[model samples]
Target: MTHDSTGLRRLLLVVADGVRHDVLADEMDAGRTPALAALRARGSFHAVTSSFPSGTGPAYVPFLMGRHPARVGLPGLRWYDRARSLSWAPAQARSYAGIDIWHVDGDVHADVPTLLDLARPSLAGMSMLGRGAKHGRIGRSVAWMLRAAPSHFRGDLLGWRRVEQQATGAFLSRFAAVRPKVSVLAITSPDKFAHAYGSDSAPVRAAIGDLDAAVAQAQAIAVRDGWRDALHVWVVGDHGHAPVSQHDDLHGWLEAEGLRVLAHPRLHVRDPDVALMVGGNAMAHLYLSPGERTRRWWPTHAARWGATLDALLARPSVDLVATASSATTVEVRHATRGAAVVQRRESPTGPRWSYLTTTGDPLELGDSLHDLDAGTAWEATSATPYPDALVQLSWLATAPRAGDLIVSASPDWDLRARFEPVSHVSTHGALLRPQMLVPLLVDLPVTRPPHRTADVVPSALDLLGISCTTDFDGRSFLRGTPVSAAG
Candidate 1:
């Protein structure tokens, strides 16, 4: 790590995965989470939008690497490489949903650096993406079993109570063991509860309550170690969750459409013409065969897709069907809504985005065309049903490893409708507000709000008095930091 002249004693980054901003806010307001509430009172709290495909592994990228997953060719939970060699093409499909989680470190773009890489001699706990942590490790055998274990067996073996308690204990031990200048701890219970029980259920509330206790324990440890004042702690959520009452087997639906589908555990489904990789059970990547998907996305999918688009759109709960029409453009379609295109143009300052709708707005962004930069685009759409869709979708469609067609489910619906032994009550991964909005907690007094989770890394670096050796999409939102510090 390249440190600035003045450095802090240490830094602690705590990630409570899948904890919703609204849930946190309500808990904090009601005084159930005293530790985080205290931190917010002394610092700043922002309900920021996380990047698209807001699942576990990929969403963590912003906090650790200060960049969107797409920036590193990681489009979250599932995706495949179109450029893979023929021999490796059949093996190119990637899924972080299970035991394959161990491959995350190797899958990202080679040039990108994780937080552990920049901050060496560090330790990571309760995490799957601890690529650079010196002492990080995972039990592959246990993970593999968990992937196929029955719900009842999993319930008895890995209950939320034990998982969270162990997580807190692990955080304390790892922090003491390494005394790292920078580190991270990801709690698994919040996300777990949301999946097992609905997000609005009592169990979910109790999970956040347990998180509050964990935060308290961390603070107590810091103070007891006489490093409270010297420690810069950040408690944040990677992504939020929404209540899911239903499911749709998009993979099976594709197969029923007379198209072959490639999915995990079923990789031998020979000559697969379409790869249906679902993430967070709410969004899916429909990778098409050469004639349909192609290298350059169809210039006008509305014309090229013919009745296929209509058939896909006609599916129940099918919210949005989007494809990259060009390098700088994204064509969006809906069953009953309408059509629109997101285009990027080089501005004098930098790249600018425009929302062009030929008919009814697919995203319902507006009726007329509008052009805006990243900030303004965020401002205009942050509170909409599809938060920050213009900025997020434009970059997502153009991401080097993105799927041919991005499909999002309607409210209360998720894509992974079959194969799972247990059904999820609540989930994420779509561009909806519940999935995109996450609570951010930082101890520093910010000069401005860093509306994106990607800003967490840069902000932490700024507080640690270190200079990032690489450029990042996320910049420090803290006060007294210069623009060039991110690099």
Candidate 2:
């Protein structure tokens, strides 16, 4: 490994999930966050775009790998893999006998190489501290690397605040002793607060304040340790949030439309009375069954039945409509082949009811259509070629195998029904501005200007004075020659 004689440069990444820039600005104006305010004043700050589907899993994957979900093949958190006859959900594993997980679905792939391997060849030591159970794999991998080369690893699998403290302490202790060439510290508290409370809620503000304190601590350590001249600190978020209402009786509406609702027996739905299925934000996937009455008359009155469904969906709470084109099939996207039949009709109801069609089982909706087609005026939906579709409740009544139609409430309206109710008021993941745009602030010892998340990887590489061999979705904004240190 190459070493720099100038001293080591340190990097800190703090991921605050579901925090919006506007909310941060408001808090800063209110004087609730002096630490973040100081960083903003000393460094460059702007909202950088997150990945498609704007959820945590998708956003973090790209933030670490520097690649798009499509390129990495992880389009969303849950995906049905046809080849392996299995479905994949975040932090859950489903086995398909005699089939490789990657081969099951083309979309189940991870495209970019993680920082774990990239940082290995350059740094004197490296460590990764993860706050959530969902990041167990990352923590374990970092531990393994450290075990292999004791001189090159340091990390703790602790909660957000503790992890930040330990990581900052470790960097100070190490810099004072060996003065390693590079180090990274990541904090994950802001995201947790946003998920538990709405973005604008008091709890979120407090979380941001806590994160600011942690950053200030890290900055102090940098100065005291005399590494401030070469250090770089980066604050970024994986994705922002959107407000959504919770529904308790999602299945009740489906039952009213003449559909039988079933349960998974093992995985209990959070809201059993009304909800069949739920997504974090307003997006939901509902299952429908062609009950005795609907099935018997389905072929004869399919058109009229669809019209009735369209009318019911036209209600205030209801959004888009997609009816089944025929028995035994639902179409999630236009090119979504393999089904025996597909939903064909397309209509625009209004700004509220934008996209309408007779499609497939509610649970299988994909990200092919635009959200504006369903009546939303969000810039992310309006500008993108592919807008997310919101499924109507009545459409779930027509599926032969559907458990119940999944329904999504409006942005600020909670569905009073619950089938695994997810209550994040501010959602991001659609190519929308609120979800896609995130802030990147630099507070390193070096005089490098702050930049966006897209510049993260290159910035790290720049600290090491090495040109990246891989092509990145973003660029490096840090300007300076890298300093190397010998172990």
All candidates: TM-score? 0.89, 0.55
lDDT of 2 by residue, 61-167 (tens): 55555554434544333322213323443212221111222232223343445553455322211122121222122222444333333321121212343444444
User: Which lDDT tens digits does candidate 1 get at residues 1-487?
Assistant: 1223456547778887888888888888998888888878767788998988888888888888888888777886878767772232345777776656667777776688888887766777666577788755322236533532343335532454564465557667767666677777777667877787876567777777766776677667777886666666687788889888888887777778788888764777767777778888788887767323336565554464556667878888678888887888888888877888889887786667888887778887766556687778888888789888887888787786777788888888898877653568888999888888998987656888778988888877667666877877676787585433322
- Worst ten in a row by lDDT for model 1: 144-153
- Candidate 1 TM-score versus the reference: 0.89
Q: Candidate 2's C-alpha lDDT?
A: 0.43
Q: Once superposed on the true structure, which residue ranges of model 1 sit more than 4 Å away at CA?
A: 1-5, 85-90, 137-161, 290-294, 300-305, 481-487
Indicate the TM-score of model 2: 0.55
